[model samples]
Target: MATEGSNSPLRFASVEASVPKITIQFCIQCKWNLRAAYYAQELLQTFSTSLGEVSLRPSTGGVFIVTLETFNQHSVLESHTIWDRKRDGGFPETKELKKKVRDIIDPQRDLGHVDGKKSATNPPAHPANAGHTRELKDVAAQVVDGPVKVSKLQDNRPESLGVQLVQAQNSSKSQDKAECEDCK
Candidate 1:
């Protein structure tokens, strides 16, 4: 029901209760724990045939109401359980360490070639590795320390990004619709 390019998704006038239902249940996991609940909300929003939104707070009962594309058609109501806290927690990343490291060398960036890449090469006390001291140090640092951790940001994985999720959701919807037609 969430057709793009709408001013506001219909949440009223019972506009979402009308979308037709398919045979297979859209979601498998029960909305129980925090993760499950969040996941359920994600799935519902992802798969909803009509405009949909989910809201849950610590103050009220932790349940998600899914208003399907029934807005135009049926005026239906569906509820699912949700989580109390987000599984991925921390803060908005105040700084990105990777960008910081990159900035030390390339104030302006490269031409997409490996050789054109600059390094935050440190000066050596004894210039044995002279020209490549910074490169050596950078490699050594990576080996000694590890990859930078995004401790502040929660669930910053590519799959978790909304753009990627929406792309995947669209592909999945097409496939599901195809499969349903094939079955009939």
Candidate 2:
């Protein structure tokens, strides 16, 4: 018969052997593929041993979502979203993304200098001649203002269901206006 001590080690080993899988999906329509891939690379680099796999799925309609899936006995035990663009509004910073993954993978693990309070309060010193620096918010605004080539026939594509829905709503509004004008 296995003693309590032996069972403890077995239980611990089983728990340690199971690592969660992470999937990050980004909207191709929103031009977020590069951003999603970057985040996937960062997460894989940071939690290589703790993560089972990291997948990048292309989607549409401004979707930028990160999900974690835990498995037990060859079946998914739990699945949850780490972030959603519709809820969070924008891409997360690299450090912030690291923190989120760390929280889920190893809650007790310390991120050393990355999680220090001073690191949060002070900006890292840069070389004097590094040229003008812009805040993240400013850079984000510039990216938003940058021209994006939007295809006029996107509504006809199956991947652009959200675009189709928006077009339908707009046409219904135009039809209502036309009917009201006829009554006048």
Clashes found in each candidate (C-alpha, N, C closer than 3 A): 20, 0
Query: What does candidate 1's lDDT look like per residue over 1-184, in tens digits?
Result: 4568878776645443323221112222222246435534543443353223433222222322221222222543432211112222321121221122123323353322233455567453666434344644554454456543222112333322222111111123343332322123
Q: After the best TM-score superposition of candidate 1, give how far the Cα of residue 67 lies from its true spot, in angstroms.
A: 7.3
Regions more than 4 Å wrong, model 1: 1-33, 48-50, 57-69, 72-184
| Superposition TM-score, candidate 1 onto the true structure | 0.17
Model 1: lDDT equals 0.31
TM-scores, each model vs. reference: 0.17, 0.54
lDDT (0-100) at residue 130 of candidate 1?
48
- Write down the TM-score for model 2: 0.54
Best by lDDT: 2
Residue 110, candidate 2: how far off, in angstroms?
A: 1.8
Error of 1 at 2 (Å): 37
Tens digit per residue, CA lDDT, model 2, 1-184: 4577674443333354345878899877556789998999988877787888899998766678998877646664777788887798777888887888788778887776568645565676677523223332343344466633333332233423232112111122343332221122
